[model samples]
Target: MAGALDALWSQYTWALGNGDPRTDSWLLVHSPIPVTLLFVCYLLLVVAGPAVMRCREPLRLVGPLAAYNLGLVVLSGYIFYEMASVCWWCLFSKAIELLDTVFFVLRKKQEQITFLHVYHHSTMLFNWWAGVKFVPGGQAFFVGMLNALVHVFMYLYYGLACLGPRVRCHLWWKRHLTTLQLGQFVAIAVHSSYNLFAECPFPDGFNMAVLLYSLSLILLFLNFYYQTYLKGKQDKLT
Candidate 1:
């Protein structure tokens, strides 16, 4: 069965083929275009979403936001499951995830695309590109799987939050969501750093570009969690 599936998938490689890996294909995958373009779109979202908050209405943002998060939840789950079977699945799934940013752009709901959102989305894309493009299968597959597990609940909560005024009192999982996301980044960073260094003694040559990218994501996520959650708590206490 696996052999037949491999044969079928091989025949369809052209349809799924992305980078060349021979002539600078590696460079192209790690290029800044995807990240820069996504950042610009995200900035516009943050700036514009609040401006139009009055007209757009929080409830109006609920449906699409819910759907988007829910889709990601499922996507993360599938990717994680496939990775467990054939670790390389993380790379394929991450590359496909670049489209999520497009959804954020189209929705014009910048509020949904928070700093954590942008950081997570952008890093995941580049990290996977790095993985598939260079690092084939190492600790990466595990990290990606862990992330997908968390997304299932994260998106569900976000979907509920989108409902606004009619939102159930217990629907608010924002605090826990942020906490989980932070932990996810920290774990990725630690595991990845171990693989990168000889400290953990994992195989080398998986791809340095993405290793760096994942590390940066950890730093940014830590900062974001500190500012968004910790600071918020401090203000509340004050």
Candidate 2:
């Protein structure tokens, strides 16, 4: 059994572009244990966090939430900027991004913590670990850059919305944020699919993984958009 597992692991690593080094730095951050541990903690917190907030009144985390969103904007920007050359930034940024859910849980915004949200965050952690561990560079950085660009706008919107009702009144773009997210997934799917026919150094498995992931997100986000916007509008009209 152990031998079979080892063989499977070896094939998985090869599919992820193991031995392709686009950047050189600390070995510890790229190691599998730390990455796995970080994600495990994130998933545990995802389950435990809301339970802790279950009996408590929702905390109005205006100041902290704003700081958190803006901080991510900066971090995402930096990761996008440095992704082409520095591999550590992607891994570090992904680890820190889990704080997004922590803030949601802290504020008792349970409704915001949807399947799509958890799936997006958890998969990102896992996928980026694979990317950072194996591919770390080349065309693999494209998704990070696009996601970072989307996050800059997404988090900025959230930060402004967190300010209060007055600020949120001007924030008429909430639905558009979902639209942007949908666009991000579409863009990623299209870009990743290009690798199917083109000759690229990036592994085919990585590209296919991205394409499939993006398709899943697209379906989820489309459902969210229809339910949140289209259905809501129709209901009001009826």
Worst 10-residue lDDT window for candidate 1 reads: 19-28
State residue 197's C-alpha deviation in candidate 1, in Å: 5.4
- In model 2, what lDDT does residue 58 have? 84
Against the true structure, what is each candidate's TM-score? 0.61, 0.87
> On residues 1-238, what C-alpha lDDT tens digit does candidate 2 reach at each position?
9999999898756644544454324553334666678778988988898999999888888888899899988887887777687566766677777888888888888788899888888788878777776677778778888888888888899889899989999998888888988999898999999988898877898899999999999999999899888997898999
Q: Which stretches of candidate 1 lie over 4 Å from their true place?
A: 1-63, 85-116, 196-215, 236-238
Clashes of 1: 2
Tell me the tens digit of each residue's lDDT in model 1 across 79-196: 7677745444554455445545545545555555666666666566555654554444555566767777777777677667656667757775777887787687667666666667
Which candidate leads the pack in TM-score?
A: 2
Candidate 2 accuracy as lDDT: 0.81
CA lDDT of every candidate: 0.60, 0.81
Report RMSD for candidate 2: 2.7
